[model samples]
Target: METDSKISKKTSQTILKLQQNEITEHAIYMNLAKRVKKQGDREILQRIGREEGMHSKLWSKYTKRELKPQKLKVTIYSLLSIILGYTFVIKLMEKGEVVSQNSYALLTKEVPEAHKIYLDEQKHEEALINMLDEDRLQYVGSMVLGLNDALVELTGTLAGLSFALQNNKLVALSGLITGISATLSMASSEYLSARSEGNADAKKSALYTGVMYIVAVILLVLPYLIFPNSKYIHALVTMLIIVVLIILSFTYYISVAKDLPFKKRFLEMATISLSVAGLSFIVGILVKKFLGIDI
Candidate 1:
């Protein structure tokens, strides 16, 4: 009787495995439906896919089926592994809810079934979010570097140029124009580079970088508009602005990431800003000598 019972349990476990595989496979197909633009069609398909797996698990659990000792351990381990792996990936996917919501905006484009799956996943994501602490540095690092880098580089570049060009209105105008164009170009280049690394939101980092650059340029160059007669004066005022920008950067880092030492942070920013300025000064001297212009 015990042998017969064991045989029955093994048969039930085999059936559960088959059912779980079928459901998981179907779920993959339903997910792929998005690539083919079958959003609504994929919704029902997705639910069906999930139901299949649930049904299999429910059956095995309810039946007290004794799967082979090794196989049962492996199955338990695999499930645990999946849950752990998806915790991080699912949060990332959740962060892109804005993108997914847009994907479902149009009625014609809406895959009702896919939409359902999305909604379900959204809830799942929310639950996961509640379980996980919110300190993951998803967009913050990119944004911080974008803003800080632009402020340092562009401010130093313009100040160095103002020193070299010294009070020529035309030279100042030319510098401003060049800086604006360069900022935009750099931003676009960064965005494309990030996009190649993967994900649409990744491109936003470049935009933020470019925007920060424009702010840096404006902060430095705005003083020149009023003091066009004395490039030296403009350069002096811009230096004051640079100091303010540096302090602000340090303050921001302190506020957001309190672990960094103030002196270390200040030195890092100063090193980069001064290094760029030095390089720009050299470039300006070479251009002035080669072109035979007094700029």
Candidate 2:
């Protein structure tokens, strides 16, 4: 490792930034480790935290200046870990480390230890992959089933109802009734399916599915409820937009956690969902005309 005897001002500033980042990340890992229940996972996070602390020390040597961790960064990442799950927060942090890894390459000439730090960062990614054991992730299929079914079925139902009913309040009322009934039906179906499959946590799986479905129902129906005086077409458009956003968010989460392709999954789900809504819309128009129904 080269000494800082001839380091330039710019190089010193960069070293300080790296030192800050390392120490801040160390705090994040340590904070999350303390929150986790599993001893094995806690130990791994502590080990990584110690490695980050060592990297900060290495940078401190080059700058010959003491560095403090950024409290804000630590707090933000800690909160994200609590809300989004440790696996997601860690993966997100690793993505940031990739940027730091590039910066480390630039500093290798001035600080040879940067190369070693970069290698350790790569290892951290692999370690995180092995440490992921979130219960929600294990039952991702149940959530997916619930979310997708609600999106496709409710979106189409609402679309058809918008045309057939042609009144926003009526449409909202009809949607709420249908959504609640379907949520219960879906929950019971999931419970039976999981039980048949011999899943030990069949009840929990069913609860997750039902909760996810109800969440989707509430989100999709909100526009109708909130804008009951608006045009039904406007409400339908808002609902579709909400559906697309939900698909994007859920697909991105699955992509990051499961190492799946984002674009393909997102496009496929969105296409099927929208296609069903479109067909349902046309059917609604035909039925309304044939039945000569006017509200």
lDDT string for model 1 (101-217, tens) is: 644343113223435544655676354334433222344555556556665666556655665677746545865887788787778877787788885775667766676567666
Q: TM-score each candidate.
A: 0.45, 0.92
Note the residue pairs that clash in candidate 2: none
Which model scores highest in TM-score?
A: 2
Model 1: how large is the Cα RMSD against the reference?
18.6
Residue 86 deviation, candidate 1, in Å?
A: 28
lDDT of 2 by residue, 1-295 (tens): 2436777666777887778878888888899999989887888888888888988898888877776778888889888778668877777777666246567677787777778777867877576656768777888899999999999999999999889988888888888899999999999999999999999999989998999899999999898877756578888999999999999999988887776899999999999999999999999999999999987
Alpha-carbon runs more than 4 Å astray in model 1: 1-137, 250-259, 282-292
Model 2 lowest lDDT segment of ten: 95-104
TM-score of the candidate numbered 1?
A: 0.45
TM accuracy, model 2: 0.92
Best by lDDT: 2
Task: In model 1, state the lDDT of residue 58.
Answer: 47
